[model samples]
Target: MPDLAYYASLPRTRGAAAALLLDDLGRVLLVKPTYKQGWFLPGGVIEAGESPLTACVRECQEELGLTPRLTGLVCVDWAPPRDGVDAVNVFVFGGSITAAEIAAVRLPPEELSDHVMAAPEKVPELAPAHIARRMGPSLRGLAEGRALYLEDGRETPFG
Candidate 1:
């Protein structure tokens, strides 16, 4: 368990986001937070009374300048150890948009610097630490499909 005292003292924030995974064929969507200046999946804090899915769609429009139909919830992560903040819950949804659409996107400096599709192996360089960690197993699961989910986010040791 984390330090509840510190967590309770800090303000809680709710956010929604989507992860657009594309191949190195020059495609994918990611955002750079102005406060942290790190490459992260596109999405932002949910508005005071917005649904998570709605917020995710809105964030994709605002950050990537494209409308994405979220296909599935890939991962829900709880990030820790950022200043006094208790946790940052990240909701990752799988979706796709045309490369032509991404080319037309104009990102504001506050949200994203640029969006590009890169090779899956290169993701570690672009993804934030917490995000990268969460993605590691998820990607494997994506490749393995239902067989992977049978364990529910666990890793089996290799001989």
Candidate 2:
């Protein structure tokens, strides 16, 4: 077994979960957070001992005030450390919401300012570069009906 010091020396990565929710017209649902500069998906950091999917569902409920029936894992992206932040492993899940659900969305004024259903191409304009980069692989995963693994939001050739 490894020593405690050896274990402590290993690099630590944070886990975050986000859902790629789409409307009937296939527009992506994006949220504008009051606390952040750019728009983001309806999800947040994983809590202690919580699974990524659990965090995704919980965030959706908290952010949008409704429980979403997530289709499945779309892509898992390993984001490199940047902007003085630690590395993060982001799990993106895919789901579709109805018009009723859209009507039911209630954003907490302190956490979020607004929400919009944007075409996929507009994602780059709304979100940060890192987040925008993930959309391609995530959408491809949803379309292909398979999960994908990515690094810095780009799919790798090797398994």
- Candidate number with greatest lDDT: 2
lDDT of each: 0.61, 0.91
Q: How well does model 2 score by local distance difference test?
A: 0.91
What is the lDDT for 158 in model 1? Answer: 29
Q: Model 2, range 14-63, lDDT digits (tens) per residue?
A: 99999999899989999999987998889999998899999999999999
**lDDT, candidate 1, residue 108?**
77
Listed per candidate, the RMSD to the true structure in angstroms reads 6.5, 1.8
Residue 6 CA displacement from its true place in model 1, Å: 21
Name the 10 consecutive residues with the lowest summed lDDT in model 2: 150-159
* Candidate 2 RMSD computed on C-alpha atoms after optimal superposition onto the true structure: 1.8
Which residue runs does candidate 1 get wrong by more than 4 Å?
Answer: 1-13, 23-27, 140-159
Alpha carbon lDDT at 37, candidate 1: 52
What's the CA error at residue 124 for candidate 1, in Å?
Answer: 1.3
Off by over 4 Å in 2: 1-10
